[model samples]
Every structure is written in structure tokens, then in C-alpha cells.
Target: MNSRFRRRSLLNSSEDNDPMSVVSNLFDVAMVFAVALMVALVSRYNMTEMFSQEDFTMVKNPGKENMEIITKEGEKISRYTPSGNKDSSSGKGKRVGVAYELENGDIIYVPE
Candidate 1:
């Protein structure tokens, strides 16, 4: 009778240990890691406004030839790239401001 009870207990323990449980646990861990990575990246690049409902603008690689201007307004997003022209104007608008880059790479805008 003791041997029969031990055999039944072993079978019960084996049944409780499902192989699929391990896979599910691994999937949960992966999802948590992915979320953490996304949060870190967003904060690192100051991109938290991207998830907000208000309008926002972002400049990537500012002052460089490959610079990109991203603007989000009222559920619409627009991307503007420099046309490789030394003068950044459409030849129709009057100049309203001037921007100067400081030695520390900070840009200052002075309205004319």
C-alpha cells in the first residue's frame, strides 16, 4: 500500500509540472523586458510628448545635413527635410527670426 501511494504522488507531481507553463512564463518575462526597453528609449530621447494628445515638434540631428523636422498636430504628423539649399526659405516668406548656435551646441533664437 505504501508503494502504491508513492507512485500516485509521483504521478500527481508530474501532472502539475506542465512544459507549457515554462513557455508562458518566458513569454511574460519577454513582454516585461520589451516594455522596459521602450520606456527607457522614450525617456532617453525626450520623446514622451509623442504619446500625449497635444501638438508637439521634434528636431532630429539639428543643424546637420541629414536633419529632420517632425511635427504632430491634431492627429496628423508631418516630416520636413532640408532641400540642401544654403538658404532655407521658399522665397516668399519674410525673415522673422535668426538662430545662433552657442559653443555648447545650444541654439538660441532671436526674433528680428
Candidate 2:
């Protein structure tokens, strides 16, 4: 009598058909998916940090050259002079007041 005949697998007819191989293959697939997910998360995080503009400053005034007004939020608003004073619809006079509108619809004007 052979030992192979005496020993039998509960689910398979022969030792060659061991179910552990299937379990190992599943584990390998799961590991690969886990690694892929981790890499994707890291890449997404890096991309978000690269292109995000939340930390950048904004320019408030585009046409002005000599004067720059930096807001509380770090935005730089600029005002410039035309070498010769030309009268236009836009006031050429000095800034008389600076005002900010609040969320409650109230305007707060800074004393000049």
C-alpha cells in the first residue's frame, strides 16, 4: 500500500491540486492592488500640492505702476502714473477712501 493512497485531501482528489495555490494567488493579486492604490494616492497628493493656487498671492490692480496696495489677505493692488496727466473718466486724483464690504452687507471704509 502506498502512503499517497492512504492520505487524501478533503476537497481535491490529489495533492497536486492543493487549494493553497489559489489562496496564494489571491493574496498576490490583493497585494498588487494595495500597492497600486498607495501609489495613486501618493501621486494625487503630489499633484494637488503642485498645481494648487490657494497659497499664491493675487494682483488687485493691473494698470498702476508706482503705487501698490497690499490687502490683509496678501493681495497686491497697484496704481501707476501716466508721465503726463491726461483727464479721463477714471479719476486721476489721489485715493480718497478704501472700503471693504463685509459678509453681512456692511461696508467698512478705512479712514484716509
Candidate 3:
């Protein structure tokens, strides 16, 4: 047999099938799956704005006692929560509109 053929056969031999190579392939597939899952979750919840450089404001658990307001402006982020006092009103702003939450969690605003 030729030397080049011998070397090619040696490289293609069953004995060269290392178990570690299988593990490496599995690890690569797992990394791809993890990245895909992260992208799906970000798009599912409309959370792409959280990763952008533009200003955005998001409300979590709206109309609940544990509601949270997250605002991002420039490179700064701020979170606001209620003080748990239901009887206090401090702002001088007038009520220009009324908002009603429907059964499907959609809000409708009606101007005064």
C-alpha cells in the first residue's frame, strides 16, 4: 500500500473515534439551544427595548400593590414603587383623561 493511503486509512480508523469528540459536539449543540431560548424569551415578552440604547419606560404588574415602574433614559435606569399610602395625593396635576382596564388586560383611555 502507498504511504499516503496508509495515513488516510489510519485517520479514518474506528479506533480514532474518541468519546471526547462526541462530548464536544454535544456541548456545541447545547450552547446553540441556550442562545435560541434566550432570543425567544426576549422577543416573546417585547423586551427588546431593554437591550436598546433608546429611552423606555415599562410597567410591571400594573394596577397591583406590588407594581413596579422601570424607566431608562440615556445610560441611567430608575425604578419607582408606591409608598403604600392609598389616601395621599401630592401632585398638582389635573386629571385630563380616564383609563379603564378591560377584562383582557387592555387599557382604554378617554379624554376629559
Candidate 4:
């Protein structure tokens, strides 16, 4: 038999049926899917950080006795002490406000 014909017959024979090819193909497909999922997750996380603005104009800067927390959605939550007293009153001393910049180049403080 010719070499080409012999090779073709060998490939067509049942003994040449290798199960490793199926396993290797499945492994390749799974690897591709895993890489795609990881990339998607990383992209989504990066997009969230990109969309959130961290900088905000100081509507009121907190002093040593006060605490100010700014949210990613531009909401400012402030906690401060009463005028001269050292102790804090939850109902009377705590103040909440929203910080926004006005069109006239001024920062507007809106009490919430």
C-alpha cells in the first residue's frame, strides 16, 4: 500500500480513535470560558470605580471636634458637637446636609 493510503486507513481505523482529543477540546473550551468570565468581572469592577466621583467641594470642613463622611453619590453626612458643649446630643446636635456646587461658582449647602 502507498504511504498516503496507509495513513488514511490508520486514521479511519477504530484503533486510532483517541479519547484524549475530546478531553483536550473540552479543556480548551473551559479555559476560554474561564478567561472570559474573569475579564468580564474585572471590567465591571473597573467601570464602577470609573463612574464614581471621589472629589467634592468642602461645603463645610470638619474641625477637630467634628466628623464628615462623603458618599460616592455626592451625599455629605456630618456629625458635629453643639456650639460650646463637649457632649453630643443625637436629636439636637447632629446635623445632616447635602453639598452641591452652584452655577455662579459658589458651593450651596442644603440642610437635609
Any runs in candidate 2 off by more than 4 Å, and if so which?
1-16, 47-112
In model 3, the clashing pairs are none
**Tens digits of lDDT, candidate 1, 10-72:** 888965779998899899999999999999999998888888999988899998989999999
In order, the Cα lDDT scores of the candidates are 0.91, 0.61, 0.92, 0.64
Instruction: Please name the candidate that would achieve the greatest TM-score relative to the true structure.
Output: 1
Tens-digit lDDT string for candidate 2 (1-112): 4666556444456666787988998999999999999879879755333234344333334566543432232343333334434556357568878999999999999978
Residue range 7-108, candidate 3, lDDT tens digits:
999899985678798888899999999999999999999989888999999999999999999999998989999879865765757889999999999999
Task: Give the residue spans of candidate 1 off by over 4 A.
Answer: 1-4, 7-17, 85-112
- Superposition error at 14 for model 1 (Å): 4.4
Q: How well is each residue in 1-112 modelled by candidate 4, as lDDT tens digits? A: 6999999987899745988888989999999999999879879755344344663423234665454433344444333343646465545655689889989999989999
CA error at residue 6 for candidate 2, angstroms: 22
lDDT of 4 at 8: 91
Would you list the clashing residue pairs of candidate 1?
A: none
Instruction: Report how far off residue 41 is in candidate 3 (Å).
Output: 0.3
lDDT of 1: 0.91
**TM-score, one value per model:** 0.65, 0.29, 0.58, 0.34
Comparing candidate 2 with candidate 4, which one achieves the higher TM-score?
4
